[model samples]
Target: MKSGFPSTSPFRLPPWAIRLARRQQNSMAGAADRMRFVIQLALTNVTAQTGGPFGAAVFETKTGRLIAIGVNVVEPTNCSLAHAEVVALANAHANLKQFDLSAPGMPKLTLVTSCEPCAMCYGAILWSGVRNVVCAARGSDAAAIGFDEAPKPKNWVATLEDRGISVTRDLCRDEAIAAFQRYQQTDGRIYNARKGLT
Candidate 1:
């Protein structure tokens, strides 16, 4: 474990990113608009050289008010679990002060991600208590840029729906894919599990 005690900003998102999110807090309503916001975040993360080109946010399901935002912090935090979706959810929990978003009196939250989540994030959504999931790019888009998604279920979408969490995919897909491509063109680092380990 490589660590010397984490600071207050646990996820370590860029300062500008934190500001941008604050300025736009609860600023989006439509799904396409929200997707655009997160896509921009992903692009900014790449250009900022902070982490990977992935972004995610939590929103109130009914009103579409952005609750919290997160960009990838895997390499910076040296923790693979710091994926965008996980960070977003964790931030939401912290801000809302509720481990289960669906806890009584809590707003029904939605997870909006710039791209389809990997196996780990997919599992996170199931336990996050979010009522809905909004996705921009497909998981294959992440894979094209040399990211590993692990062995996520093929029926993942249906699976979430079965659990009462609605899943919406491809909300501004081309734009999200563009963000991934931008990362690739800029030679952004692609970190995944060390192959041939097990």
Candidate 2:
């Protein structure tokens, strides 16, 4: 007698898709372009799943390597802390197998998020050691779409930059807002525990 079971395999993209991704990565000339591309990728991923309209990606700036793409999975995963930035950072760390993101000489990595990170994600970025952050939308943009973003101090950017993590805001702002608008139009579930309060 023998037991039968399906074998598990690692996820792999088609060769053509990989080539296309590489080309796109190479073509990103500035922070806006890269942030737009990643946010679009994130939107595509999240739209396929049941989650809020937020996405994130991690990229190695020096080599133009697309490290990881993440979509907000909080609603699908039933976890409040599963923000897109957090999920993306976790994926990047796991893929690289290096948790000390701040180590000297580590390749410069940028975290691009569709919206400004909430308080939880902000902390995650600091600890994850990404050297730079690019955001397409501000927290108020998400709040306008009915998502409860945490209250951040007015000097948040300065705070992050002071720690060696440069912050760029409003990259591809219009496109990011459009993504949230589409989600709202589709009646996507807006999971805000403190909906009315914050």
User: Model 1 segments beyond 4 Å from truth?
Assistant: 1-10, 196-198
Candidate 1 lDDT over residue span 51-146, tens digit each:
999999888877777788889989988998999999888878777767898998887888899999899999999999999999999988899888
* lDDT for each residue of candidate 2 in 1-198, tens digit (9 for 90 to 100): 000000110222223323334455353546776787767755664466446678777777665567765667776567787777877777677666668666676778888899999988988987999999999888999999788787777888999999999998898888988888888877888888886674
Distance from true location, Cα of 111 in model 2, Å: 0.5
lDDT of 2 at 34: 74
Clash pairs, candidate 1, are none
Task: Please report, in order, the local distance difference test score of every candidate based on alpha carbons.
Answer: 0.84, 0.72
Predicted model with the maximum lDDT: 1
For candidate 2, list the clashing residue pairs, or say none.
none
Model 2 compared with the native: what TM-score? 0.82
Q: TM-score for model 1? A: 0.92
TM-score of every model versus the real structure: 0.92, 0.82
**Model 2 CA deviation exceeding 4 Å by range:** 1-29, 195-198
